[model samples]
Target chain A: MSETNELKVREKQEVAPSAELTKPGPVFTPHVDIFETDNSLTLLVDMPGVKADDLNVDLRDDILTLTGDAKPSLATPGEKIYGEYETGRYYRQFSLSEVIAQDKIDAKLSDGVLRLTLPKVEKATPRRIMVQVD
Target chain B: MIYRTLFGAPGRRFGASLKELEEMQQRMDRLFNGFRDRSAGRVGVGAGVFPAINISEDTGAYYVSAELPGVTSADLEINVTANQLTLAGERKISKEAADARYHRREREAGRFSRALALPGDIDADNVKAGLADGVLTITIPKAEKAKPRQITVQ
Candidate 1:
């Protein structure tokens, strides 16, 4: 790896408790990258150890909520000797703007990463307005 | 995960009130979230390591696991020699369009190298690794001489 390509380590941060949750476990705020194009917004969420059936993505009243539980699927049975990380669930929420088409949003989970595509509302799509001359 | 259940280290207990206090602190942190640059993954505080790892041991082998979300096996390189295990990989995330506007950018992409010293010698030829659900798990069996043998209590 080149000097510039060296990856700096960043510890995982837990999501602050903002509401009453029944589940009991450390909930991490998954890392995410969000970008927008002319017609849609793309969100890439990193959620390692979470399976497709264990993830939940909900959008209600313009609020988008994501939750996933990380379970040990690989059989690496042994006594704990040392641990640099703790297993836990992931939770995050984002309030969408009016431009997003909440009903048209789509989500896919692959290799522990969740990709969400949120298409814009029809009238919100960006387009150049041509001037009409007299 | 089984590790979560196995993490009952001695002397760390949280009573009901203490748990409530933790929740209160978390709520306060969110209140002042704007003051901190939370958009960058590099700035967040937690365990303070990239691709957090865990190690476990059985009578005959040692198991090591690391989180590498969105990273494929093709990008990773693992080497074990004597008692050291070196994990080197480049995490390549698809780049956004040049004109694409970003609302929030936290996930990062780059090369990372981590070398861990094992507790005992390993059978390098018998080492096995697998990547599933973005987690890389390596099982390293101990060398014949490194394995502890129980003598018959004659």
Candidate 2:
């Protein structure tokens, strides 16, 4: 009876390990500040080490992908006595809802910051109705 | 009696002399000029502090490009370790003036660093870097195992 219980426990652990492996890896969420205006939604993403030429923003179907690379700051080989930040490639993805107008989306990168302007679809925006008096 | 009443003492006479006053004025003028010279070059671009880089991937390799306008080839450094790539440089602006009045100066001058971690593992040894038209380009070839391969069906 004890042998059967041990086998069941082992099988359960193995199944959990596989399940975890199939899950998505950790997402490197960029620091983003979103603002909604009358005509569009402005998204500002802080890509500190990124350069304007290196940034790529793509929208396909409902998914938006942001990819870029950042170069290191030191030229000659020296002892890195103190360092906190890890400079590397940046990747982020976001799923947009139907309210977004894909065709009107515009993006710009300046000074390592990426700004995306997402316009809402006409029908998605709120409309004002006129009232007439008889 | 008149010299004693007017000059008082030798030290006082020296301090109140025209030559001494001229020397003190020159020292004060030098201090003020130094302050003006330092403050004249203070131009700050608050939101403009990041380098620009471009990256693209093909079937076999990944390409990255960056705009380093004032950076010289000797000032730039590129390194690739495992799947990470970094580009770092220092931008120094040295201005000499014989008799030039400043109208307006707006340029970033300081040390700048940028780094990017690649998505997939790359062959570090095969990476190549080049600079053209103030833009630096780096090509990182994908590893054999990391490259996409077509499998044949038996």
Q: Once model 1 is optimally superposed onto the true structure by TM-score, how far is the C-alpha of residue B121 displaced, in angstroms?
A: 1.0
| CA lDDT, candidate 2, residue B91 | 53
Interface RMSD for each candidate model? 4.3, 24.2
Q: Candidate 1 DockQ score?
A: 0.31
True contacts kept of 2: 0.00
Positional deviation of A17 in candidate 1, in angstroms? 1.5
lDDT of 2 by residue, A45-100 (tens): 65545676777888888787886656554111232212222345566676775467
For all the predictions, what are the DockQ values? 0.31, 0.01
Looking at model 1 chain A, report the run of 10 residues with the lowest lDDT sum. A1-10
Q: Which TM-score value belongs to model 1?
A: 0.76
Top of the candidates by DockQ: 1
